[model samples]
Target: MAQREVIVGSRVGLHARPAALFVKTVSAQPVKMTIRKGDGAPVDARSILRVLALGAKHGDTVVLEADGEGAEEALDAVATVVAEDHDDPA
Candidate 1:
């Protein structure tokens, strides 16, 4: 498995829009991914509900993990999205 730890950058955290964007990124990846807030149990990163339910607040550290081919790249891509400040003007 590959892993990437990132700090949430959106002002509102992983709420509606941010969570949806993160899930979209995860969905695009070839490998299955899971995310965990701090030491909490991991949840499917592709699930918007699971991600929003994590209640990941701004500045919170979250760990993304994936196994299989291209896991490292997949984690990196998803991590980038998770760490971006989606609330800001794009």
Candidate 2:
């Protein structure tokens, strides 16, 4: 598995909008991915509810993990989504 720690950049953290955006971003990747906050059990990066439940607020550190072909690339992309605050909640 590959892992990366990213700080929540959005003012509201990975809440509704951010979480939704995160889900969308990771869902596009082919490799399976998991996200975790603190020492919490990793949750499906593709699930909005699971990702939101992480309660990762602004400044909080979260870890993303993946195991499969191109796991590193997939994790990196997820990290970009997290770090960039790329959420379009409607």
Candidate 3:
């Protein structure tokens, strides 16, 4: 298993568009990934609903975990997505 803690930089947190973007990114990965807020139970990173249910706010630290082939790369990709401010113009 691979895991990493990252602070969410999205101005709107992991909701709506930001959540969708994160979920989409994770879903495309060839590994199972989960994300959790604080000490809460991890939720499927590929599910937009699950990710949005986290109610994570800007600057909130979250833990991303994954196992299986390419787990490290998957975790790294998702972690980067969560740490980015999607609200800002790309």
Candidate 4:
């Protein structure tokens, strides 16, 4: 399994559009990925509802996990999205 930690960068955190984008990215990965707020239990990364339920706010640390092939790439991809400021205009 592969795991990584990233800080949520969206000004409003992983909600609404940001959550949707994050879930879409996770779903596109070759491997399934799970995410959790801090040390909380992992939830399906592909589910917008589960992700929204996380209530991950800006600057909150989240852990992502995945297994099987391409796990590293999958983690990296989602990590990038997690660390991006979706609310940014730039």
Name the candidate that leads on lDDT: 4
- Poorly placed runs, candidate 4 (over 4 Å): none
Clashes of each: 0, 0, 0, 0
Lowest lDDT block of 10, candidate 2: 81-90
lDDT of 1 at 56: 96
Q: Estimated TM-score per prediction?
A: 0.95, 0.89, 0.94, 0.96
Show where candidate 3 strays beyond 4 Å.
Answer: none
By lDDT, rank the candidates, best first. 4, 1, 3, 2
**Which of 1 and 2 is the better model by lDDT?**
1
- 1-90: candidate 3 lDDT, tens digit per residue: 789999999998888888999989998999888899999999888888788889999999999998888998888888888898878775
Error of 4 at 89 (Å): 3.9
lDDT of each: 0.92, 0.85, 0.90, 0.94
- Pick the TM-score winner: 4
Candidates sorted by TM-score, descending order? 4, 1, 3, 2
Clashing pairs in 2: none
Regions more than 4 Å wrong, model 1:
none
lDDT of model 2 at position 24? 87
lDDT of 1 by residue, 1-90 (tens): 778899999899999888988988899999999999999999999889899999999999999999999999888888888888978865
Q: List the residue pairs that clash in candidate 1.
A: none
